[model samples]
Target: MGGSEKHAGLNNTKLTERLETAFPLLFASIGCIYLSVKIFNPHLKNKTKACIVIPTVDDLILFASHRAQIAQYRELEITVAGLAEASLFTSQKFYLNQNSHINKNLYTTVISFGDTKWNTQQKSKTSLRKYKINDERATHNYSIITKILKPRYKIVKETRNQKGKIKNPEYSYISIPISKELFCDNLTNGKPFYTDFYKLAVPNRDKSGKLKYRIKFEQKELNEMIEKINFDYEAEKIFIKACHTAWKHRLGKLGSDSKKPGASSFDKLVARDFERLRVALSKSKNFESFRETITDFWSRAGRIQELTDGWEKVMILLEPENWKRGRDLALLALVSYKPKNEKEETALKKLEFDDTKGEEDE
Candidate 1:
């Protein structure tokens, strides 16, 4: 019925009659075909003919095809919502189920539709806006998916007004994928492990529902982290361990006072430590020197004993060739939250920090 004029030109009387006969049965099956009609207008009305058409066996295939297409259309909407919500696990599952044979180069298309105010009398007056985002990879890695879904903004250049400040500073939405490898990597884990990292790095809004800190990694740094991860078991383990250590240092029993630090303070500390470690790793010529730097860093936070427990594995990760990986792992560790159970909480509490050193030392 919605076909173009070209397709309508090809229609014959017999086919048209067949479609006319089938339409009523299709509408009735969906409860859209009304049996009774009444007139509300206070005017003399003429009698109308009620035409009821019965569908044949030939129409069943067409109906089934239409239903399948409708289902797929609805599924596309659900998939788009899943991407926005950062529900990669569910999205991937749905994607896999929908595609019988997975394509290696499949990408998601996300279209955000907006419109200006519409006039009640004139519908054509409205200005429609469409922001299409179609580059996001159709994959199942939390790290990659979170990066894609995370809100990003770029400054729009403007001239300064008479005053020193710009009259209006504007920002535009932007998407920068971490790496091409992330898009191509089929070996990456799709688990929700990155949730803890996001939770630690991006804290909840304050009582005023405003963000107090803006701590986020650069695209280059994120790319390095992804490259280091490489979907390798050892690398993932190291990254997770680093996250655990960071959690213990920042939010565990290592704080300067009884009061918990603000989110801003915590994020700043994590960022600072990450930079310090990155510099140290670059400067270190051998494992021994890097190990000493690591020891010194943890000693300041009263985590020397904890470092000792994992010395062997940590030492292997600190080798010269693996310096970048080590630095990225350190960043991951410093920015991830590892939720602790009662026993783990108790253990953290028992670990003592050096009371002599102030928070400034850390």
Candidate 2:
């Protein structure tokens, strides 16, 4: 047999040269620090070669365009020092400057190394950090980058019966991406709702020392709501107001206290209201029936006057065809947390007292 010819592998030096040639703008913007720290350091330790995979020509073009677009934003800056300080090359944490323009496309490139999922066995070794961004101008795009992680089971082995049918399957823990829109919603009182949504939806350990999730949602539902809002400006406005209304009502129930509601209480409120809306929509045969259900819900919640005055538009969004979107929006609104203002506090105080008096009279 003829001997097979061995080809030389592309080492970090060659890879760096190739990257610098193909993506000059990216190379210049991130500088040698990113290339040395993020791309090559791990290879030196593990004796493994790391390479950027441009899956298609279209992807390469898109990435080049994104890098070019990011270069244009003079105000948009990433601190290479900060990246090193955070150990972002090895860690999952990525930091950006506060009050900076966060181009979504730019973010995809910067955090490209962070995988959406990892083996459950590696959970303890993984560290995720939260950094604050204070740009109201970039709220919409900022929300789009916040991720939601979901736990999934992967089949590793299957036991077959004598008949050649599978009897028992062994599964292993893995993480998967659910959606990005979990935190992609309107700001509350001019502040981003990303932190609040993270507390509510993301899985965390509880007092019992076990991982728990307050609520769960599907990607399709959030995508539907996002699509509707993005296409129709009026629908976007209505959705925002609906979210605000739900937050107001939730805070109002707190009775003017400075104390914030805990995640469990918040989850309970969202679940109760979501179930009510879901059931109501599922049973309604037409627009009129849906309207009646909404009217009844609002009336029972003591928001009849608000419904009559301004919520007609919100009602329009809950029609038969848009019921699912409406339900998802309501779910988002109920779970979303916003800081209470002085005016809202005073109103809540009055509402609480009025309700107490009504109960006494009854």
Candidates' RMSD to native: 17.9, 16.7
1-362 per-residue lDDT for model 2 (tens digits): 00011112323332223655666545443331122112112222122111121211224444465445434533112211122211222112222324433323222122122222442221111222232334334343333332222223445888899998889877653322323222322221233323233223333344554443334434333433443333233553555455556445644563333345543443344444444554454445566775676556554455533344556566566667665455445445443323366654333222111222121210
lDDT of 2: 0.36
**Winning model by TM-score:** 1
- RMSD of model 2 against the true structure: 16.7
Across residues 12-74, which tens digit of lDDT does each residue of candidate 1 receive?
Answer: 633343677677645554421111111111121112111111112223554455435434543
Q: State the number of backbone clashes in model 1.
A: 2
Q: What's the distance in Å from true for residue 241, model 1?
A: 3.3
lDDT at 92 for candidate 2?
Answer: 20
Cα lDDT listed for each candidate: 0.37, 0.36
Which candidate has the highest lDDT of all? 1
How do the predictions measure up, each by TM-score? 0.35, 0.34
